[model samples]
Structure formats: structure tokens, C-alpha cells
Target: MTAIAEHKPAPPKPGTGGGDGGFIDLVLRFRELTILAALIVLVAVTTAVNPRFLSAQGVEDIFLNASILVLLAVGQTLVVVTRNIDLSVGSTVGLVAFVVGDFVTNSDHGLVVAVALGVGIGAVCGLVNGLLVSFCGVPALVVTLGTLYVIQGLNHYIAHGEQISAAEVPQSILDLGNGAILGVPYLPLISVVVMLLVGYYLRAYSSGREFYAIGSSPEAARLAGVPIRRRVLTAYLASGVLAGLAGTLWLARFGTVIADPAKGWELKVVAAVVVGGVAIVGGVGTVYGAALGALLITTIGSVLVVLKINSFWQEAIVGLLLLLAISADRLVALRLARVLRKRNARHG
Candidate 1:
């Protein structure tokens, strides 16, 4: 008679260092490498179709366009790493953009004050989300969704059918948005700096790795003495602050704002994060990968324009890419499950 083995899978450890950690490191690098390869192929194909697509301005445009999404994706990565989501970020961005733009225009505030206001407002929004989702024990999805509607309503009431225009915005703020330094645009530069900082933190800091542990297995993480609630709250707070910063930059970039600015952007940001190799189910991904994903999405839009393809197809392509990414994640999960089962059987 053959004896059946009971299965038991070990939970991932925060800041783990061993064969397992090395394997995870390899997976992370591989995911980012695949994205870079795809991006290169995309750029090459589009440039082949239209030489002008590879022009200096065209490249800069792609990065500038991706800057906002990259920032949002970085913040989203932090939240998602902890098995949480912030649906309110889109609305938060819209509110900050309009409120900061209006306040700056009326008060003639300097760039520093405008930025401070945007960050502060975003922090308030994030704090509300963190408090509710963390201490109140509400589901993150439901909490963020509710906040989304509430924030959107508040923005509409404040705007009152009015919009901020370039004429009303200060030159210093506009310059920060549109101006380039040493042949590089400020928008993309800012995004790159944020991405690097986040990527380093996630890889180098114990608390940051705890995020992955929490997402991988919250019960296990708690058993390991990790402070799950505090980390989750911090994630939402970071997401909000980044969204707010993005809003202020949005005003500068466009020199215009409406109540509905950035409406329905949450989906795009999620798509970018997921496509960047972050599992929707959580426990894996990097800001570097997420930023590359943003760049890829932006490149796709530019590719359509340079190819003179129908604009409608852009959404279709994005949807298809999202499906593919999700499928890829599912496959990875299956493989991981299989590996765990094998390891369990060996012990059994």
C-alpha cells in the first residue's frame, strides 16, 4: 500500500536571505528584463514604421507622458505589495490638482507652497483611507471605492463648473511642469528619482520587505512579529501623497484643470502596475518594473499615433495587454504552487 503525504507550504519570510531569497531576486530581475526587451521591441517596431517616431522630441514625449502614470504606479506598487489597493488615488489627484491650482492662482503662492499644499491635501486623503482600512478593519477595496466617490463629489462642488487655465497659473509652476533641465524634462526626471528611491527602499529596507511578507501571508507575517497594520497604513498614506504630487504636476503640465481631471485613471494605473509584473494577488513586484510598465503603456499610445492607427484600438490593445499580464501572473502562481507542493512532499 502506498502512503499519501500531507501537504504543508511554508510562508515567505520578510527580508529572507537564502536560496529562496536568491530565487526571488532572480525572478524580479527576469521580470524587469522581459519588460525592457518588450519595450525595446515596441520602440524599434514603431520607429521602423515611422522614422520620425524615434526623433528626440518623440522619445522625450513618451517619457513625459508616462511620468504621471509612473509616479502613480510606484505608489500603487507599495500598496499592492501589502495586499491593498487605493481606488481613490484618481479622485485624489483630481481634487489636489484643482484645489492647489485654484489656491496658487488666487494667492500667488510660490512653487514650494503649492507643492506643500498638494502633498498635505493628499496626506489627509490618505490618512482617512489608512485609518478606516487599518484600524477600522474595513476592506481596502470597499473603503477606497467609497472614498473615491466622496472625493469626486467634493471636487465637483468646489470647481462649480469652473476650470483653471494657463493664464491663471504662475510661470514658475508652469516651468516646473513643462521646462527641461540639461536636455531632460523635469517631469520624467522627477518620476525617475521617485522610482529609484522606492525601488531601493523595497529592496534594502526590512520594513519594506515586510510588505511582501504581509501580502504573501498576513497571518504568517503577524506570527513573525511584523506590524502589518502600520505598514498597510503607511502604504495608503504614500499612495495618497504621490497622487497629490502627481495632481500638482498635472496642473503644471497642462496649465489647465477641470473638476473631472484624471477621471477613470485608477484603471490605467492598475493596468500599468499589473503589466509591470506585479501580481494582482500580491506578494511580488518592484517599482522599477512598474515604472517600466508605465513607459511601455505610454509607448503604446505613441506607437498608435505614429502609425496613424485608429485611436479606438488603443483601448483594445491595452485591454488585451492587461489580459495577457493577468494570465501570465496566473501561470506564475500555478508554478509557485507546484514548487511548494513538491517541497512539502519531500518533507512529508
Candidate 2:
């Protein structure tokens, strides 16, 4: 009988580059590139359908419309990066927006104070969610879902069916949303600034890395002495503060606040983050991607208008885009898994 060679693993590849590793690194690190390509495609298509879609005013409209979602998505990205979710953002924004409106209309609070109060309230809500998730060891989904209803109910009770109209809002506060700097809307500018800071922190800071580490492998991060609990709590708190800021912007832009100002917004924010290439499971996304995702979602609505399609199709299109994005993510995961297995066998 012929002697059979033992089942030995192959030798490691020579170069540190090439094959699946490089591809995955490119996908993970340059997710923004994909988003940019998608955005370009969207713009091109829209412009083809309606040249007016590329007008300066049209561009401004898109950016302004996308700004709030961008802000919300950035916060969602942070929490999701840590393998957590915050379903309460919509309710948080609603509550805070109404609070700001109420303060501005019913009290002697200045614009600055009103803005601060809204953000503070949001931060406090976030802290509660964070504490429950971190200290109580509750899953983020369950915790946030519970808070979502609780916060919404609280908002309804506080508003007591009251609504603040544009006539009642201060000019200064409205300017926060309407004002433009260097020809760009202030809200979009603020979103850009926030994105820059968040992107830098995630890319360069140790604490920020802890989020990725935790998401990548919680057990490993814990063993490596990462303060998982504290960081996670901070993530949720940051999300809340951002949501509050978004609420204030909503108050300014809409010039009115009701208990349901941002109903169902949390889902949209999550969809934007996920569509932008952020991993739903966590630890693999960027602020840039989240911002791009927001832009893309906003563009979709504009595109629909340009195409003169029914407004009803907007939600359906968004759902379709979300499904495609999730499918793409699943494919990427499968390819990465295959690559890892092959590499392990080679090294074994």
C-alpha cells in the first residue's frame, strides 16, 4: 500500500499583505469609500432624472434635512460600536424637544439655557439607560426598548397635549437651525464638526479603542483590563447627549415642538448607521460611514421628489435599501469567516 502523507497544515503566507486579510482590512477601514461611491451614484442618478436636483439650493436642502439624522446616527454608531443599541433615542429627542419648546415659551429661559436644558435632560436619560445596562447586567436591546416607552409616556405627560408654535419660539433659537455659515446650514456644519471630533477620538484615542476591543471580543477586552462597564456607560451617555442636541436642532428647524415630534426616528437612525456599513453586531464602523449613511438616506427622499414618485414609496425604498445593506454585511461576514478559517488551517 502507498504510504499516505500526514494531514499537515500548510505554511503561512510569506507577505503580511494580499488575499482575504487585505480585502477585509480594506472593507473595514475604508467603509467610507463605499459610502462615497454610493452617494456619487445617487447624486448622478438624481441629477440625470432632474438636473435641478444639483442646484445649490437643492444641495443645501439635502444637507439641512440630513443633519439631524447625521447627528443621531453618530451617537447610534458609538453605542453600536460597543455592541449595544439605543432604541430610546426617538423618545429622548421628543421629550427634550418639547422641554426646550416649553422652556422657551412658558419660562424666562434664554435660548442658550433652553438648549442646555434639552441636552442635559437627554444626557440624564442616557445615564439611566447606561446604568441599567452596565450595572444591572441587562441586555442593551431590552433596556433601551423599555426606556423608549417610559420616555415617550413621560413626554406625553409633561406636554399635556400642549404644542409650541413657531410664533412662540425666539428668533435666536430658530436661527440655530436656520442660520448658515459660509453658505452652509448651521446644523449641517455642527454635524460635520461633531463627526470630525468623534472620528478622531475613535481613530486615535485609547478609550475609544476600548469600544472596538469590547465589540471585537468582550472576553479578551476584559482580560486585557479594559474598563468595559465604564466605557459602555459613557457610550450610552454620549448617545443621549447627542440625541438631546438633535432635539434642540429639531425645535429650531421645525419651530414647533409636540410630544411626538420625532416619533419613529430611532429606527431611521439605526437604519442609517447600519446602511453606512456599521456592523449591526458592533465594533466595526466609523463616524464617517454613519454620516454618509445619513446623507444617502436624505438623498433618497430628494431623489423620489425629483423622480416625481409617490411620497408613499419613500418608506418602502428605505426599507429596501436597509435590506440590501444588511445583505451586503452578511456577505462580508461570510467571506471574512472563510478567510479566517483558511488562514488558521494554513498556520495550524
Candidate 3:
């Protein structure tokens, strides 16, 4: 009886994800669960300290602030998952923001044209980064870093020590950024739509899955005839376009285009993606997770303020959280390995 009991199959791990179990597994994954729990705890503590933190205005502020970062983080997820990075996104946004503002200032190119211009400019930047990395065989880090400076330099030169003030911006554009539908802010709504579209493609399409394949094992991806070069290029282009859109929104939301608005934003976006549970190593994370990561990062800043923590401690706290997230991932991985080994040993 004891032997039979010992031989009985153990129930599957809660989120091991087999067949009908996939969605459950996704929710229970250590990384996703950690971020969600941390966010909840942080929110609760902040609300306790100041009930105003959960007020409608406060909630709107958190989501609005998170919108651009969430957009950028989602795009960055695709690139990082494939073992690449785009440091140029910050510069891309700055340049496009100023340029779009400048364009609309004199010509009145209309909102659609202005947005197209920004996205096109960004796509061009992404294309350059992609070409150098994919065809020229340059390291992605080096390429994007160089592009970052090059773009920022261009933006500075174009601005010529001038700024695009709110007076110069079109009201319609600002309305798009500031307006709400059914009491929901447009910025967050825009972010949600982009997130859903990208996430769906990544989850439902073969080409999107190819990105995961490339990140997992480039050599294997090559063997499997994955179009590595094209995919990398597309990834960068998507990132650039999103950054550009963010820049356009930046202009709309702030109505003051400085050459340095998003100067150091790339690091924050990367932090969100990492904290969201997307493996920095490549090929293991969801855009939804990245979005949550953005929300969590944004909320932390607000919570710190609500709790009256020193402003200086904000970045430090973010850094600590990132470290904790990575460590948790490693611990979970190690635990899984041990479990597998023990089970194999018993079977043997």
C-alpha cells in the first residue's frame, strides 16, 4: 500500500501550463505574481497613509503618467526579448517631439500629418539602428548608444536653444492627449489599445513567436530558417515608432518641447520591462507583464510621495525593487531545477 501510494502521480504544479492550464500558469508564474503582489501591497500602504492616494484624480494621474512608459516598455519588450536593446528611444522621442511641434507651429500640418511625421521619423531611426546591427553585424548596444547621441545632437541643433511653448501647439492635438472618453483619459486608452494589439500579435502569430525563437537561441533560429535579420529590423522600427508616438504625445501633453524632455527615459523603460518579468536574457516575458511593470513603477513614485518618503529615496527604491525581481526569478529557476532533478532521481 505504501509503495502504491508513493507511485501515485503528484498533482501538476499550479501554473505548469499544459493544454487547458496555460492561462492559469501564466497568472501564477513567480515573476508575474511577485509584481502584482508588490503593487497591491504598495498601493494598500500608500492608501492607508493618505486616502487621497486612491482618489479619482490620483488614480488618473498614476495611469496617465504610466501611459507613455507603458507604451515604450511594451515596445522594448520585443527588442529585449530578442537579446537586443534600444537606448535611442529617449532621443527619438525628444527629437520627434520637438520636430512635430515645430512642424505644426508654422505649417499647421494637422494632427494626423503631425503624428505620421513623428512615427515616420522614428521608423527611419529604427531602420538605421537595425541595419547597422543586422546587416553590418554591429553590437546592438553600441549601435543604439551611438544613435542616441546622434539623434540628440540633431535635436539640439534643430531647436537652436529654442523651445516649443504651449502657445505654439494646436489645441486639437492637446485635446487628444487630455481628453477622455466615458471618463477615461485618452492617454491610458491609447496605451491599452497598443498593448492589446502588440500582445495579441506576440501570442497569436507565428512571426511574433519567431522573436522568442530568435532570442532563445539565435543559432537554432537560424537553423529553423527564422528571418533573423528582418525580425530584428522590425523590432527596432516598432520601438522607434512607439517612442516617436510617445514624443508626439509628450508635446501634446506638456505643450513645451525641450530638446531633452525624454533624455534619460530609456533606462526607465528598460527597468519597467525587467521588473515586469521579461527576462533580460531574452525570450521569456509578456507585454502585459511589461505594462504591469510600468504601472508598478509609476505607482511606486506616487506612493513614496503619499507616504512622505524622501524624494532622494525614489530611485534607490526602484533599484532595489529591480534587484529583488531579478533575484526572485533566479530563485524560482533554481527551485524548479532542484525539483526536476529530485524527481528524475526518484524515477531512475
Best-fitting candidate, scored by TM-score: 1
Residue 335 shift from truth in candidate 2, angstroms: 1.7
Q: Rank the candidates by TM-score, best first.
A: 1, 2, 3
**What lDDT does candidate 2 reach at residue 24?**
52
Instruction: Please give the distance, in angstroms, between residue 137's alpha carbon in candidate 3 and its true position after superposition.
Output: 1.3
Tens digit of lDDT per residue, candidate 1, span 87-161?
Answer: 998999999999999998899687999999999999999999999988999999999999999999999999999
Residues 150-248 of candidate 3: C-alpha lDDT, one tens digit per residue: 998999999999999888888888887788999999999999999999988887787887787777668766766678899999999899899889988
lDDT comparing candidate 1 with the true structure: 0.86
Q: In model 1, where do residues sit more than 4 Å from their true spots?
A: 1-24
Ten residues in sequence with the least summed lDDT for candidate 1: 1-10
TM-score of each predicted structure versus truth? 0.93, 0.91, 0.88
- Candidates' C-alpha lDDT: 0.86, 0.84, 0.83
Ranked candidates (lDDT, high to low): 1, 2, 3
- Candidate 3 versus the native: TM-score? 0.88
Model 2: per-residue lDDT, tens digit, 1-348? 222223322211111112354665577556668778878998998898788999999998999999999999999988997889999999999998988898898776667897789889989999999999988999999999999999999999998998989999988889988998787789999999999998888767777777777776676567666788998999999999999999999999999778868999998999899888787876677778888988988898888888989988878877887898888878887887888899899999
Task: For each candidate in turn, give its C-alpha RMSD to the true structure in angstroms.
Answer: 5.0, 7.1, 7.2
